[model samples]
Target: MKVLLYAEATRLISKSGIGTAYRHQIEALSRVGVDFTQDWEDVYDIAHVNTVGPGAKNVVRHCKNKGIPVIWHVHTTPEDIKNSFVFSNFYAKLSRRSLTRKYAQADHLIFPTQYTESVIRRHGVKVPGTVISNGVDTQIFRQNLCKAREFRERFSLNGPIVLGVGFPFKRKGIQDFVEVASKMKDVTFIWFGAKILALLPKDIRRILRDPPQNMIFPGFIPQEELIGAYSAADIFFFPSYEENEGIVVLEALSCECPVVVRDIPVYKGWLENGVNCLKGRSNDEFEQIIRTLLKDRDLSEKIATNGRMVALERDLSVIGDSLLKTYEAVLGRCRS
Candidate 1:
């Protein structure tokens, strides 16, 4: 069936997780051979709205008036937005009320993770919802020795590389990553994303100003380069405080790179510490995990293999069927 897939501020967020998710949705729909359009004015069967911006609210209302079923994908919640950007906590306070009203307008809601679904539910969003992952395209993100070698040479990077991907937001644990990097001076640490200097808080700006000699903030890279980076990294050390579903994590896992993430509620059921990947609560814990994986070849290989399997399950090809079903179910309910 035909669908209208829309996301506001695509240019602004194209390097962020939300934009990655929007791209994944488009890829997933296309893989399932579902006809879709990005334009809101286009004639379509359903409207799948990804952003919570003013234009998004307008699109949802327009769809509703036309009796078109609208799927609101909850990419950002009030709690997740609090520690991000300058004055973000204040924005979060305003967003709670705004999100509650905007979310209520949808025919159904789509959450990237169960943790996110629960968070919005606590905010009193009673709209029926389903947990659908922001899946990865395994074909593009898989392991590649040639690309990995090229990435290291291009960046002038050496062995035992530790990598983190995403914007330098406080909520993403950039401070913690830097602190952990400081403790490990021998190994090279690279963070592959950037944010406007003016938008970041003073503390974050200060840290970025004088990062450890071993640590490198190379700013955002293209997807092809990112896939190479993931393939080259020895450990995908993401110390994020919160995430609906981290697309970078999936990309790392898909590349068969072992990961070390913070012990957060968002990874509760899926990420078991010492199983598919390691989890740390503090900088000390994160540093220790990285050292262990670096020295212990068996442990690293096991986690990498297991993590790749996990990514395969959430691959775009598999996720496409789920999206097709969800779309059909929503349309069927509307018909009944």
Candidate 2:
């Protein structure tokens, strides 16, 4: 069956998680051998809308009116929108209202994680939803010695390197990351992301100006370079307060980099603490975990091996099969 993969604001979100997620959908669909198109006017049997912009609302309406099944991928919820930009929290209520109305128009909903599904339900979304991982490309994101060396040489990263991905935002626990890095002057902390400087709040802008000597903000780097960063990092420290499902975490796991994340609800069922990854409640705990991982190579290797297995389970091929099944089921119900 043919499918329409649609996402609005492609250029604007090209550097964001939502953009990465949409690309993953394309990869997953291709692996499953599904015929799909991004052309808005292209005739298709099903529509998988990945964004909630005004353009997407019109697309959903058009699809529903034509009796075509619409799968609305819930990548953004009001809960995770706060602390992203100036007055981000102030716009959350409006975002909720808009999101709920658009989501209600879909024939079905797709969430990147079960936690995302639960949150959308709480926001008054009555539509049936399914949880599918954003998935990772194990082949591309896996560890590579050549790339690792390149990353270190390019960035001049010395000693044990700690890496963090995603834009610096308060909700992402950027403040906490800075504080943690400040306390650990011996280990180099590198954050790879690019955010619009003017859109940032005063506090975030202020901190970015005078970050500790050990900290490096390389802005955004190419995907090839990012793979190297993952390979070279001793630990992937993600202190984000919330996430639907972190694509970067999956990439780190695939690279067999031991991950330390905040004890957030989104990772409840998966990301077992001390097994595949470490979980910390605060900056102090995060620092302690990083220190332990640095000293205990055995423990680091154990978790790294386990984390790779977890990533394998969410590989693009596996995600492709699951997505194909879901698409067929939705179409089958429509036929009946």
Q: How would you encode candidate 1's per-residue C-alpha lDDT over 1-336 as one tens digit per residue? A: 899999999999888888989999899988989999999999999999999988898998899899999999999899889888989999999989999989988989999899999999998989888899999998899999998999999979876899999889989999999999999999999998965889999999898889999999888789888889989999999999989989999999999999999999999888878899999888988988999999999999999999998899999988888888999999999989
Displacement of the residue 94 alpha carbon in candidate 2, Å:
1.2
User: Which stretches of model 2 miss by more than 4 angstroms?
Assistant: none
Clashes per candidate (backbone, < 3 Å)? 0, 0
What's the TM-score of every candidate structure?
0.98, 0.98
- Candidate 1 Cα errors over 4 Å, as ranges: none
| Candidate-wise lDDT, in order | 0.91, 0.92
User: Where does candidate 1 clash, by residue pair?
Assistant: none
For model 2, residues 54-162, the per-residue Cα lDDT tens digits are: 8898888888788899999999999899888989999986888888888988888999999999999988889887899999999999999999999999988779999
In lDDT terms, how accurate is model 1?
0.91
